[model samples]
Target chain A: MLRSESEAELAFRREVRGWFERELPAELRDLTFRPLPDMVMPWYRKLSRQGWIAPHWPRAFGGMDASPVEQVILMEEAARIGAPEIPTQGLNQIGPILQRFGSDAQKEFHLPRILNGDAIWCQGYSEPGAGSDLASLRTAGSVEGDDVVVTGHKIWTTWGHHADWMYALVRTNKDVPKREGISFILIDMKSSGVLRRPIRTLADEFEFCEVFLDKVRVPRANIVGELNRGWTVATALLSQERLILGSPGNALRAYERLRRLARALGTRLSDSDKLMIAKARIELETLIASFLDAAEGFRDGRPVDSSYLKILSTETTQFILDAAQTVSGAYAGVKFPMDVDGTTIDFSELFLQSRRLSIYGGSNEIQRDLIARNVLAMPRGRA
Target chain B: MSEIAGDQMLISDNVRRLFDASRALPRARAAAACWPDTDRTVLREFIEMGWLSLLLPEDDGGMGASAIDFVALIESLGDLLLPEPVGPMLATVSLLAACQSPAADRLLKAALGDERIVLAATEADRSLQGDTNHIVFDAHWADVVVFATGETEQFSLRAVAKIDVDGLDALVRNIDGGSLCSVRLDGSMGEELASGARARDIFMRCRNMQRLAAAASLLGLVRKSLQDAIDYVKLRRQFGVAVGSFQALQHRAATLHVACQSARALLYEAARTVGTANEAVACAAAKVKAADTAMAVVKESVQFHGAIGFSDEADVALFFRRAVALTAAYGTAEACHRTCFAG
Candidate 1:
């Protein structure tokens, strides 16, 4: 666990572990495997069926209303076993956004679908021209009757090909400033003129895509918050997004892999090698404290300081991955795990995949800027 | 913020008042005048205000105090870049207060009375068998230096000889830049407070307290430097607009604040649980993070403050120097990381 658990938390952990042992098929819990939709969704739906999908959601909206501790425990246990990562676009962001800003009709339509795993969502925020400067998005959505005709390209859309729909920022007014012209519109991926070209990442997985929208008409009711004010609505979940993206679970998984591999290798290592591993472990443990604080901060509506967590998680994971690669020695470039006796370990992907940790979730540089300006209230430089 | 005791707040306010009254501008103007040395008047005021007795326990006839009671006071002392060996002095006092020795009692009481000084000393390198510590802090100021000898086996209060400071950091130099002396000790002399494991235990507590205060102080220096940079970036224009208006600089400054806050949270958390497993990890983490932050913020602040920042006249440079010295004093990031990992 990332934090110390109360008796109840400990009991909950056991329950989760037991349920996972029974319900989470051993085949699905493979640490070496990445869970794609078919292999992943059933488990997600199981959690959803139990009303445990949205831990932070209110009971009124399909959530069990699990406390922050419970939510964190769920993440820790799931990540602990390398249970497939659920499609979090709906679970973490859109569901919460819709819950907060969605019209009653919108919430009634989408929130249930999201909880039930009947609908999958991808973010349409980052485009080739507008990654860190997301508000400068040029994707235009023009009003035509009761439909908004959106035409633009969105890149870095994680799971865009797998998603059934997307909630995106499109410029609804060109004459206004870059940010003010934007509107948050939900578009069906199967709509006319919608196209998805999958992007293969460094880890050799097609987990992301470029979502192409050409005159795709979305219903007017799908506009979240208000038109031209999508910036506010979209950014409403920035803290939540940061907290999720900055979690220590991923690092913990990586660290566990490193330790496991070290033990299996049976290689006699020098003191420094052991020290580096120790350093990463210490950092991972220290980061969990901050992570727990951030989680509670988000849940309790306290000022969450998650930018540091983002930096810490990524850097520490990379540190561990670096050690793993070193321990892998001559086999660092191998695509598949080289077998010793029976232990299979593919640190190549771990090393490659860890690279994007800092690049995504708004590059570490951008997070630093956010920390410097928003949190510190330091003066901005010349625009 | 709520953790501040009412008395602590008053103590901090009083310390700030005293520091401001002894404004170091004319003094800092002297260039070479730095820490471990004090402004006589300010030192006298601290003496009169009973600030000297803060580390002594009431059982020893003082306020039964600890850094937790007056951590704010320590932090504010850091903010002003006070030119006294107050930090190590207080830490040394606390060390003696915890040690069970008749000499410790007399030494601590005299230290509190401002009669005889008991400055903390650096440990002899782990390999050395006999007594030899060439890098003791404020060794020249102490009537008797409290030192850990021979890899934590011996906690000794020894009479010391002051050797002049050799290498120095570039504003407010480390602990009154003057009066820092290397000392030689006859291993046979001084009172043995504790030996072996018990000695190491006290050493950890004292070392951690020193580290916690040093990191907190560096954070204060960073906060002040960041503010100074903020002020400069606003007033000092580059091209047609104020440089402070640039998002690039703002973000960097914001990141420093994050580091400061993170370090602070860890510092206080570690402080609260001094003898726990959490304290060891927290102390090392806080030290590493805070030290790195202080360095980054200070160096970048020079650039943010521009041409003037490079000159000796810029008070921010003083902060930069103090940061450089402080970062290495209690422990460097590398050392702290080692402690964190190897603990």
Candidate 2:
């Protein structure tokens, strides 16, 4: 029943575009901040209060329950406005998972906090041993009466330092298959025996943390879905993560930065440079079309595959970042003050940050292998 | 011209159906293997369908369409790896269109239907310049011979075998194993349509037009390659999922798609701009962009296809070879880059 958009969609696009141009804050115009989670929290609250934080959530859960097309429109508007990157573990991953699979009481408690921006969440799925091969995670949790005692280390927990809660996959039945033995459990990060250590990355950013749980206790009611079926929950969350990961905000910001740097330097763009810009423009256009196609697929109740979007959006971000570095030249490495907010940043930091585009939310290499074997239906390489 | 005119979809459902039918024909492949001269039956079919005369003037028994039309038709052909004389035939018609001689008129008329004529532009020992040489060939089988040179000048008709040159076979071999011969022109057998500097002008324009058409054809080939890859990725599953579901391959396909689209947009722009006298630089830029993008897409399409794409029997490799050869044929990307950017 879901067909390509009627004229209504075009009108929606225009309205969204108009609103973005008018309401997007000046401080969010460029990638001038090391966009930390704390710096973005206030804006998150603003969007939450406006019921724009979780566009696809059911209306009953303080969300717009937007159609797939509307969800895309929201993301496009957010990118166009250079909206600050809100910490999304709560809004993007946890809240939706809870609404779909969690007990009513669990959703009653967590969904409101997420909608109010009163609680922040971080994923506790990837352990030191289980990155990529997530089913191999050794995190263990035992049900003890009204509580579950969990003990595991979750690595690469983005913004773990600021999160209020963590949803994790822990082994509940070790004798079962590696995937079936897992249980999804939510833990209060502030609970006793929960420890967090920041992991500094090459970009000199500590956006991720190593979270160690030594017998941390979570309420039994916090377990999502059936026991030892955590893999499905984890898989669902990962699908959401991949979709969010494929968003085009970073590339849009990079383009804005490129234009700003070009203007600041007063450098006359060569025809080739103009051609590059033209190509970038066309890339953006194509990406939008592809995204729309994907959204239509999602809205039609078909399984939404994020492979194409993730690959394209991430590479485009990297390309734009690379172009920005080229445009910035010698000053690319030098940090500059944000014109609106007085924060210092540099193209170098941006370039370093862009490196993660292909790594997190499943490495691009893994994505490529998926595409080759799954999409192309080529024979698998001999191990 | 309306800006929206450029956005008109080049690949329509009808064209796609035509390609599907053409690709299914066993005779098309056999005809392609024959090279320069395609099967007379196939040629007649194409001519009757108006594809062969797509760019000729309507009054001259042809379509009188623009370069964009020519590009759309040629790209469909490239997708099928149809080894028709579309390129040389189109180039010959273009050359005749640029000339005013009685011979040019006669050749143009013949080229619109069953008649075939090959252009001899690449000279031996000329170090890769695409200009037509003074050397002639035997006119015994030729209904007309176009001798073009430079921009804004007329083309003279020289009888085949009237010009003196060595290594014509090598030049012909370079152009997809087509037959070509070299000879000395005594200036006695052919009538001059334009002499001196004017002749040079006409010749350059003709060469540029040929190069532009070749680039367009390559663009078509690249686009088809991408579509082939896309179709393969969509249903091909691995590890319990479609391979296209993997982010890595998706990224590669996406990047290739962007490159192909960029080439297409530029090609359309260039074709539209070709009518304007001052758009020479723009056309050159388009040529460089389209040729480079086309070659890149075709090569990667083969690579992405893995073992199946590399086999000689696979239709993709044919497109790959055509793209590689065409990229170097007209003017190299480097030459176009320099020309467009030159002050």
Q: Note the Cα lDDT for every prediction shown.
A: 0.72, 0.64
Over 4 Å off, model 2:
A1-31, A34-38, A56-81, A270-272, A301-305, A337-345, B1-35, B38-40, B43-78, B84-317, B325-343
Query: Residue-wise lDDT of candidate 1 within A1-383, one digit each (tens)?
Result: 32346789889889988887778887776445457778888988998876678877788888877776686677677766767667888978888888888999999999889998889999999999998888888899899999999999999988999999898999999998887888988888899999999998988888789988899989999999888999898777676677777676677778777776767766575556666676666566556656665666666677777677777778778978888887777778888766665766766877888888888877888888777666656566444
DockQ scores of the candidates: 0.28, 0.08
lDDT by residue (B11-34, candidate 2, tens digit) is 333444544555633433343465
TM-score of chain A of 2: 0.87
Here, model 1's chain A TM-score works out at 0.94
Q: State the DockQ, from 0 to 1, for candidate 1.
A: 0.28
lDDT of each residue in B1-343, candidate 1, tens digit only: 2245676777777877876736754454453643445445676677678777676667756676555564555766666776566777777777777777776667766766666666665544331222453455544355566666565444434432222222211112243253344444545656566667776777777777777778778877787888788778878776778787787777667666655665565555456556565666666666666787789888989999878899888987788877877776765566677676555
Residue-pair clashes per candidate = 19, 39
lDDT of 2 by residue, A1-383 (tens): 01134488768778777766776667765544446656667777777776778877778888887776676666656655656667778887888889889898999899999988889898887888888787898989888889889988899988898889998889988898898899998888899999999999877778899999999888888889988888899888777776666555566666656655555544466655654554454344335444544555566666655765677778877877777676655666765434422433345777778888787787776666665566545445434
Model 1, position B290: C-alpha lDDT score:
71
Root-mean-square deviation (CA) per prediction: 4.7, 9.4
> Which CAPRI level is candidate 2?
incorrect
